[model samples]
Target: MGRYTMKSVSLNRLPIGSGLPKICIPIVAHTQEEVMKTAVQVVRSPADLVEWRLDFFDSLSPETVLETATELRQMLHGLPLLATFRSHREGGQQQTDDSAGIRIYHCLMDRQLAEAVDLELSQPADIRRSILSLARQTDTKVVMSYHDFRRTPSQKTIEGILGKMAAEQADIAKIAVMPQTPADVLRLLSATVSARSRLNIPVVTMAMGPLGKLSRISGSLTGSAITFGILDHASAPGQIEAGLLKNFLDELTVDQ
Candidate 1:
């Protein structure tokens, strides 16, 4: 368990940010068959949640997005689904116009397909506010996220971003930064601890790539509620296999 007492979010009766950090596996397949196959593997794994990275799909129309989401919901067998359309600027597979991306998000919210949706903190204020409002109205959880592929910022700057996400009324505040040095990873973890102590919402923080794998596994001790793991394929760098990641988390939690 973490040192700080923070509010928790329930996903299909699973409590995130309460005890051990939950693993979220991203389904980054290009075709429906591939997605289905990977989801089957994820259901058998120890992952706690599934994140659908829509940008990896070859077709991303509102119709197709909804169709895929609906199928995945059924296929996941009650697992929490996190819908993510990462923008190209933030290390996504493809580039999509802001307007089109917002439209797809609205469709997901209105249809009530995903239990949670990821909205980038770098989006325009108006756009972010609009999506947040829709999420509230639909009773969908918003995972407000920030990604810095270049390098991790100072601890204060990372904490400031988490504060802003909390101010936006997001259910979860997530920050994933690339770390160049050991100190950078430490800064990310420090920010996570600080934010969780001060903010009411759950914080999901990770230091991406090989240099920061330690941060991913130690999140439960530092106040991060969730961590991404690789299922069939990896959507981001430095993700451990789901089974291995779960064992690591279990061991750490038991030791604590």
Candidate 2:
């Protein structure tokens, strides 16, 4: 596909693709109190967005998830929240069926609890379409994502996965892969550049692990619109602290 002009995805008024990549910190707590405490710290940190990893919570019940998400949304004030139920197959902390996961997503959207919600690209087409349909009704952004914790795929494969996300009409496309070798990291970055250049929607890509640290901090150069960082803890491998990641991004950002 020919390269297209990059279109920024807005989350709570924040433009994702037009400037230096934004830093998003994950809240991976087991209890409501823990979730609140970490949120407080994230609010005071340099994070531009917060992701609540629902898989880490002890309970996956819709009621529990809804109540907690509602409170976390309020606590964040204006900081954008990206609700994610990372499936175990995709590096999530817990195991969950697709139907349950869909239910949770619907509840969050019904109340407009989050500014954005993650819908895994691995789900069936009908399921993904339903979620995207409701996201439009709720005015919520859909982050269609794919993750491979085993090994980074070939650059072509990486780009193809991102292409699928764009095909689904995702507001944002995200992919995370683990690197078994330094060259693997490069492949992820290379694919990110290609995806960013061709896709109209914003792209978020990362190579996870110590060797993948470069991909996390090199978003500005690779065309990744957002990078995940840690506040109290790391949600994914190789995530730099939010403060440090922000500094690194600032240093690397080119003056437009």
Candidate 3:
């Protein structure tokens, strides 16, 4: 594909997709104390943003989720917070129905608990649209995501998924897939580059597992504008530590 450029989306003053890929660290804690402690550590790290994986929390009630998200936002101290309730089918911590998931999304957005929110693309079409509309109304960026824990799909399938997400008016399109071979990783990166050239929104794509670690570091060169790195713990496989990941990105920038 020819040279591709992605439009940037501002999150709490940080401009994503402007230059080097931003590093987003996830807080997967089970309790308020754990979340607070981890948030403190993340704020001190070189992470560009923070993602609160709300599914990891024991309580899923609207009140508890909002309260926890508010605390996380406060502890972040201006670091853009991304709220995500990844479903179990998508490698998330909780097994929730569409109704429950939508309720949680509304609760978080209504309170402006996070600067951005992640909504899975596999949910019912109406639910996805509703959530996106709610996010827009609240001025919260939406990260429309697709996950494949078993294997990476063909480039065509991946591209189509990205297109679907963009067509939904998502602020960002994200895909994470498991790669069993080196070629699988290449396919993932190629699809990301292709999708980036065709869509207006920024794309975040990753090839999960040890065999796919290279994609995590080199994604910025291809098309992905953001990569997840670990702070206190990892939310996904193949995630490098935040400090080490920052060092790698810095070195790559200088070389380029």
Best of the two (1, 2) by TM-score: 1
Q: Clashes in candidate 2: how many?
A: 0
On residues 1-256, what C-alpha lDDT tens digit does candidate 1 reach at each position?
Answer: 4344459988778787787888999999998888889889989989899999888888878888888788889999999999898998888888767776778889999999988989999999999999999998998899999999899999999999999999999999999999999999988888887888899999999999999999889976788999999966788889998889988988776323
Question: For every model shown, what is its TM-score relative to the native structure?
Answer: 0.96, 0.95, 0.95
- Candidate 1 regions exceeding 4 Å error are 1-5, 254-256
Worst 10 residues of 2 by lDDT: 1-10
The prediction achieving the highest lDDT against the true structure is: 2
Candidate 2 overall Cα lDDT vs. reference?
0.89
- Let me know the TM-score candidate 2 reaches against the reference structure: 0.95
Ranked by lDDT, the better of candidates 2 and 3 is 2
Query: What is residue 192's positional error in candidate 1, in angstroms?
Result: 1.3
Query: Which residue pairs clash within candidate 1?
Result: none
Give per-residue lDDT, candidate 1, residue 88: 88
lDDT of 2 at 71: 88
Model 3, CA-based lDDT? 0.86
> Candidates 1 and 2: which is better by lDDT?
2
lDDT of 1 at 166: 95
